[model samples]
Target: MATRCDAIVIGSGQAGPFLAARLAAAGRHTVLIEREHLGGTCVNDGCIPTKTMVASARAAHVVRRAAEHGVTVGGPVGVDLRAVKARKDRVVAQSVDNLTQWLTNLPNLRLIRGHARFVGPREVKVGGETLAAPQVFINVGGRALHPDWPGIGEVRVLDNTSMMTLETLPEHLVVVGASYIGLEFAQMFRRFGAQVTVLEAAERAVAREDPEVSRELQSILEREGVAFHFGVRGAKVARSADGGVHLALNAAGVAREIDASHLLAAIGRRPNTHDLGLERAGIATDARGFITVDDQLRTSVEGVWALGDCNGRGAFTHTAYNDHEIMADNLLAGAQRRVSDRIPAYALFTDPPLGRIGMSEAEVRAMQKPALVGVLPMSRVGRARERGETQGFMKVLVDARSERLLGAALLGIEADEVVQTLLLAMQADLPVSLWRRSVPIHPTVSELLPTLMAQLKPLEEIPR
Candidate 1:
C-alpha cells in the first residue's frame, strides 16, 4: 500500500530536514527519508568533521611556533592522532544527535531510514513502502571519488571519509591531488609530524583561481615542508612486498616512483544520483549525472526538485541551506526567488584561510572591461604582524564606471569571517567609496579593507 503525504523529502542533507520541517509546520503531512546519518555529509564527513580536525591541526601549528611568541613549553610539541580523532568524533556526534532529536520530535513529520528510489512521477519507494506526495524534494549529497587506477583493488587507499578514522599517524603520507581537500590534509598531517608530499596533474594548485594566488598558496605550503609535484601524469599505484604503498608517476615523460605509508585520493567529488532510479520518474540529469534544474531549482519532472550536491548548483553547506530558503519562499511564502540571485561565496579552510566572493582577477581581466583594482599584502596588516602569521594578500575589484564592488579575496588570518563584510556590501550592490570613507576598528585584519579601498587603481598587467 502507498502512503499518501503532502510532501516527500529524500536524503536528509542540509536541505531536506529544514524543508520537511517547513512543510510540516504548514500543517502538511511530511515524510523525510535518509539512507545515512542525520545532517548528511556536512555532519557525517564533510564540513563539520573536517573543520573540527582542522582546528586541532591549527592548535598543533600554534604550539610548534609558540617560541616565536615568547611562550615557552616544557617539552617538545607533539600531536596525538588518536586524541585528535576522538575530539572530531565528539563534535560530529553531538551535531548528529541534536539534529536527529529535533527531526524526531517534530509534529506531522515521519522520518524514514532507508535508501529512496523514484518509482513514478511524484512518488518514491523506500524499503517496501511507496510514498506518494504532491511535492517531492531530493537532497542527497555527494561523496569522494575513487579513481579506477590500475592495481587500485589490490592496495588499500583512503578517501575523505576513511581519512577521519585514523588512530595513528602515517610516517609518510602521499596525497594524489593538490586540490582543497588534498592540500588541507597535506598540511594537517605535516603539522602532526608526518612527511607530506602532494601530486597534482595541473601546473598550479587550485587552477580555478588567479595564477598568482595559486603560486602564493603553493609557496606557503612548501615553506612548511609540504612537498609538491606539479604537471604529474600517468600515475599508478601498487602494493610493495614490504607491506607499504608504492606510487609510480610520470611527469614530462620522466618516470618517478615513491614509497609511502599511506595514500589519499582527494581529486574530486560526484553526486549520489546514480542509484536513485531517476529514469523511472522521467527526471533529467546532466552528462555527469547531476540532476538538471532551472534557476529556481526546478527539475524537469513536475512537482519534483533537487537540492544540495545532487543538483550540481552549489556544493557548500551554506549554499545548500540557501537552496531550501529559495524554494520554500517561492512555494509556501508566495515569493519569487532564484538560486542565481545569490552571489557565489566560499572559503578554503587552510591555517591562513582563503575567503573569496564574486569574480576572480582572471575572470575580470578576461571580460576586458575597465575595472578598478586594489591589492594589499598580509605582511602590511597590523593584526597579522601581531600574530606572526602573515602569509597571503587581499585583492579586490570594482566596476570603474559605477565604483561598485565586483569581487574580493581575503587570504590571511581570520579571512574566513572577515570576508563576510565584503560579501554583504557586494550583495547590496554598494559602492566602494562608502567603504573607503567608513572608519574601521584598529588592531584587526579587517580594518585594512578601508585602506585597501583607498588605494584602488586602474587595472594593469599583473606584476612580474
Candidate 2:
C-alpha cells in the first residue's frame, strides 16, 4: 500500500524538522524525508560545527591575551588542531543523535532518508518508495556553490563542508569572497597560525552591512595581521610548479598575484531547486533558483509551502525556525503572520565579535530618513576597563522623526548577548531615551547602552 500522510516535508533541516514536529503534534500524519543528515546544515555543517570551531579559536585568542586580565598559566599557550576537530565532531554527533531521537519519539511523525522527487501534485517518490499527501512542504536547503574556474579541480579548495575537518593548519591561506563564510574562516584560520589574505570582489568587506561597520571590521582584521584586497574582481587560480597554488586576481584595471598553501572559496550558496521535479509539481522559481512564495510562505499551488534557504529570504537557522513556526500556524490554525517586524540578527565571530540587528546607517539613508546616530566607544565604559577589552565600539541608529530605535551594531565583548537587548527594543519600537533613563547593571558591557543613548545626535555630528 502507498503510504499516505496529511503533510510531507521534503528536507529535515532546521525549518523542516521544526515544521514536521509541529504538524505531527497537531495530529497530522507528517513524514520528513532527507537526502542527508537530520539536522541539515546548521547542525551538520553551517552553524554547529563552525560555531564550535570558532569557540576553540576564540579560546585560543583569549589565552594569548590572558595577561591583560592578570590571569596567567604556567607555560605557553598551545593549540591542538586535532583536538579541536575532535571536539567539533563530538558536538555535531550529539546534535544529530538528539534530533534523531526526537523525531523517532514523535507519535505522528516518520523520518525517511533518501532523495525525494515530486511525481505529481501532492505526491513524491523517495527512491523506490512512493508517498502521497494532501499538503507538501519543501524545506530543501542549499549547499556551497562552486563556480567554474580554471584549475578548479586540479587545486585543493575547501568550502564550509570540508574546511572544518582540516586537522593541519596551513602556513598561508588565500580566501576568496569576503562574505560571512569567508570572513569567518579567514579570521579563524589567521588566529590558528595561518597567514590569511582575503580577496573580496566587492569594494568593501560585508558590503551588505553599514559602511561604518564594514570599515571597522576591515580595520580590526588588519590590526590582527589579515591582509585584504578590496574592489578586486575576476580571480583565477593555477597550480604552481611546487606543491602550492598561485591565485591571479584582477583589481579594477590592474592584475595581482597571490601564492598560498591552501585556497578556500566562500563566494555564496545557491538554492537546491534544480532536479527536484518542481516543474512537474507546477512550482515556480525565480531567476536565482529560489522558490517564489507569498507572505504566508505558500506557493502558487494551494497546500504547498516553502521556507528557509529555499525561499532565499534570510538563511540564518533562527530565521528558518521562525519561518517554520509561522508556516505551521498559517497551515493549521489560520494565523496570519507576516515576516515583517522580524529582528533578524547576525553575529560575526571575530576577535571581539560583531553583532547587528535591524537597519543600518546606510539603510536609513536609503530610506531618506533623518537618521540620528550614536556611537559609544568601548574604551570609555567602566566594564570595558574592568574586563580589559576596549578595542571596539557600540553604535545605535534612530529615526530622528519617530525617536524610535532603528538599528544597532556592537563590536566588542559579549556582542552576541548585547544584540538581543537591542532586538527587543527594535521589536517593540522602544524609544532610544528609554535606554538612557533605565539604569543598566553596573560594571557590565551592557552599560554602553545608556552611554550610547546619551550620545545620540544627528548623524552628521558623529565623528568619523
Candidate 3:
C-alpha cells in the first residue's frame, strides 16, 4: 500500500520543517522528507556554523585587544583550531538533535530519510517506496555554485560547505567573490591569522548595497589587512610547485598573478532543482532553474507549492520562515498572501557590521522621487565614543512630501539590532519627527537615531 499523507513536504530544510510542523499542529497528516541532516544547510553548513566561526573569530579579535579593556593576560592568547571545529560540530549536532526530537514527538508528522524522486504528479518514490499526498511542497534549498576555472579541480579549492570544515586554517586564503559569504569567511580566516585576499569581478564589493556602504566596508576590510582585487573580468588558476595556488586575474586589460594556499569559491548559489523531476509533475521553472510560483506560492500545477531558496524568493532563513507562515495560512486558514514589494531588511556581518532596509539614494533618485537624506557620524554618538567603536555612520532618507522614512543604512556596532527599529519605522510609515522626539537610553548607540535627524535639510532647496 502506498503511504498516503494529507500533506507531503519535500526537503526538510527551513521551509519544509517549518510548514510541516505547522501542518501537524493543525492536525493534518504531514510527512517531512530529508535525504541528509534535519536542520538543512543553515544549521549544518550555512548560518549557524558560519556564525559560530564568526563568534570564534570575534573572540580571538577581542582577546588580542583585551589590554584596551583593562584586562591583563598573564600568557599569550592562542586558539586551537581542532577544538573550534569540535565545538562547531557539537553545536550543529545539538541543534539537529533537538529538532529531530521535536519532530518525532509530533504524531501527525512522519520523518522519512531517503532520496525522493517524483514518480508522477502527487506521487514520490523514496528508495522504492511510493508515497502519495494531495498537496506537496517543494523546499529544497540552494548549493554554492562553483565556476569553471582552469586547474580549479586539480588544486585545493573549497565551496561554502567545505570551507567550514577546516581543521587548520590556511596560511593564505583566496576568496573568489564579494558576496556576503565570501566577505564573511575571508574576514574570519584573516582574523585567524591567514593572509586573505578577495577577488571581485565587479568594480566594488557588495555591489548590491549602496556605494557608500560598500566603500566604508572596503575601507574597514583593507584596514584589517584583507586585500581586494576589483574589476577583474576573469581569472585563471594554476598550481605552483610549492603546493600554493597561482591565480592570474584579468582586470583593466592587464593580468596579475596572486599566490594563495587555498581558494574559496563563493561566487553565488544555485537552486537545487534537478533530480526532483519537475517536468514529471508538470511544473514550470524560470530560466535560472528556480521554480516559478504565483503570489500565493502556488506553482502551475494545482495543490503544489514551492518556497525558500528553491523558489529563489530571497534566500534568507527568515524569509523561509515567513514563507512557511504565509503558506500555512493559505493552505489551512484560506488566507491570501502575496510576497510582493516587501520591506525586507538585510545585514552584512562584517567588522562594524552593515545593515540596510529599503532604497538607496541612487535608487530613490532613479525612481524620480524627491529624497531628503540625513547622515550623522558615529563619532557624535556618546555611546559610540565610550565603547571605542566610533567608526561609521547612520543615514536615513525620507520622502520630501510625506516625511516618512523611505530607507535607512547603518554601519557600525549593533547595526543588526538597529536595523529592526528602522524596519518598524518604515513599516509603520513613521516620520523623522517621531524619531527625533523618541528618547533612547542615554549613552547608547540607539540614540544615534535622533542624532542623525538633527542634521537634515529639505531636499527641494539643495543645488544639484
Candidate 4:
C-alpha cells in the first residue's frame, strides 16, 4: 500500500522547500523528501560554507593590507584552517537548523528523510515506504563532476564539497578548472597561505566572458600569486614519491608537469538524476542527464515538473528559488510567470567580485546586434580609490536604437551588490539616459554608474 499526497517535492534544494511550503499553505497535503541535509547545497556545501570561508579569506587579505588603510597591525597575519572550517560549520549549521525548524512546523507538510526514486508515473519509493502523488516536483540538484583522468582513482582528489572539509591548509594546491568555482577557491586558498595553480583546458579562464574581462581577471589573480595554465590538453595525474600529487599536461604540444600538495577538481557539476528511474515516470532528460522541462518547468509527464540544477535551465541558487516562484504563480495564483522571462545574472565572489547581468559583449556581437558600449575603470571611482581597491572596471551595453540596457558587468569592489541597479533597469526597460541622469549616493562604488554611462560610445569604437 502506498501513502498518497496531493504533491511530492523531492530533494530539499532551494526550489523544493519553497514550493512545498506554498503547496502546504494552499491547503494541499504535501510531502517534502530530502535525502541529506535539509537546506541542500546552498546551505550545506555550495554558498553558505564557501562564502563563509571566503569572508575569512577576505578578512585575512584586508588585515595584511591594513598598512594601506593607515591601520598598523601586528607583525604578521596568519590563518588557522581549523578555525576557518569551524566558523563555516557554524554558519552552515545555523542556516540548516532554521530551515529544518520551519519545515517541521508546516501544518500539512510531511518531511521525509530518505532518498526518493520514481517507481511509477505517479509513485515514488523512499526507504520502506511507497509514496504516491499526482503532482511530483524534482529538485534533486547537482554534484561535482569527476573527470576520468589517469591516476584519478589512485590519488586522493577533492571536489568543491570535500575541499571545504579540509582541516589543514595545503602548501601547494593545484586546481583542475579555471571557472568561477575554481578561481574563487584559488584566491581563497592563496590568501590562506597556499601556493596555488589553476589549469584550464579552455583557451582562457572563464571562457564565457568577454576576452578583455577574462584577461583582466586573470591578471588580477596572477598578481595575487596564482599561476595559470590555459589551453591544456592530454592532462594526466599521478602520485609523486613524496606522496604529493603531480599533474602533467600538454600545452601547445609541449609537455609540462606540476607537483602539488593537494588537487582540487573544480571542473564542473552534473545533475543528480542518474538513479531516479525517470524511465518509469516517462520523464525525458537531455544528453547531460538534466531533466527536460518547458519554460514553465513542466516535465513531459503531466502533473510532474522539474526545477533547479536537475532541470538544466539555470544552476544558480537565485534561479532555483525563482523557479519555485514561477511554479507557484502559474499553478496557484492564476498567473503566467515563465522561466524564459528571466534575465541571466550571476556573481563571482572573488575579493573584487565580478557581477554580471544579461548577455556579454561577445554574445551581443555574435548576434550581430547594434550596441552602444560604455566602460569606466575602478581607478575613476571615488569610493574604490578611497578604499585602495581600484583593480577592475565596469562595462555597460545598450541597444543602439532604443538606448535600453542590454547587459552590464561590474568587476570591482562591492560589484555583487552594485550590479543590481542595472539588473532592475534592464527589467524595467529603462533607457541608458535615465541611468546617466539618476543621482546615486556620492562616494559609493555604484554611484560611478552614471559617470560610466556618460561615456557610451558606438560598439564600433570597442577595441578588438
Q: What is the C-alpha RMSD of each candidate to the true structure, in Å?
A: 1.1, 1.8, 1.7, 0.9
lDDT, residue 338, candidate 2: 69
Q: State the displacement of the C-alpha of residue 454, model 4, in Å, after optimal TM-score superposition.
A: 1.4
The superposed Cα distance between candidate 3 and the true structure at residue 365, in angstroms, equals: 1.4
lDDT, candidate 3, 222-290, per-residue tens: 887999988886678899999989988786567889988899999999998888988998989999899
- By TM-score, the best candidate is 4
TM-score of model 4 (CA atoms):
0.99
Is 1 or 3 the stronger prediction by TM-score?
Answer: 1
lDDT, model 1, position 226: 96
- Across 299-410, the per-residue lDDT of candidate 2 in tens digits comes to 8778788988998887888888889989878777898886764776888877678898878777777787688988878798787787777778898889898888888889
| lDDT against the true structure, each candidate | 0.90, 0.86, 0.85, 0.92
Model 3 lDDT at residue 438? 87
Candidate 4 per-residue C-alpha lDDT over 1-464 given as tens digits, one digit per residue, 9 for 90 to 100: 99989999999999999999999999999999999888878999999999999999999999999988899997899999999999999999999999999999999999999999999987999999999988999999999987688778878989989999999999999998998999999999999999999988889989988988898899999999999988889888899999999888897567898999999999999999999999999999999999999999999999899999999999899999999999999999999999999999999998899999999998888878789899988999998988899999999999999999989888999999999989998999988888767899988888888888888998987876
Q: Which regions of candidate 4 deviate over 4 angstroms?
A: none
Off by over 4 Å in 3: 74-76, 458-464
lDDT (C-alpha) at residue 207 in model 3:
91
- Supply candidate 4's per-residue lDDT for 1: 100
After TM-score superposition, the amount by which residue 319's alpha carbon in candidate 4 deviates from its true location, in angstroms, is 0.2
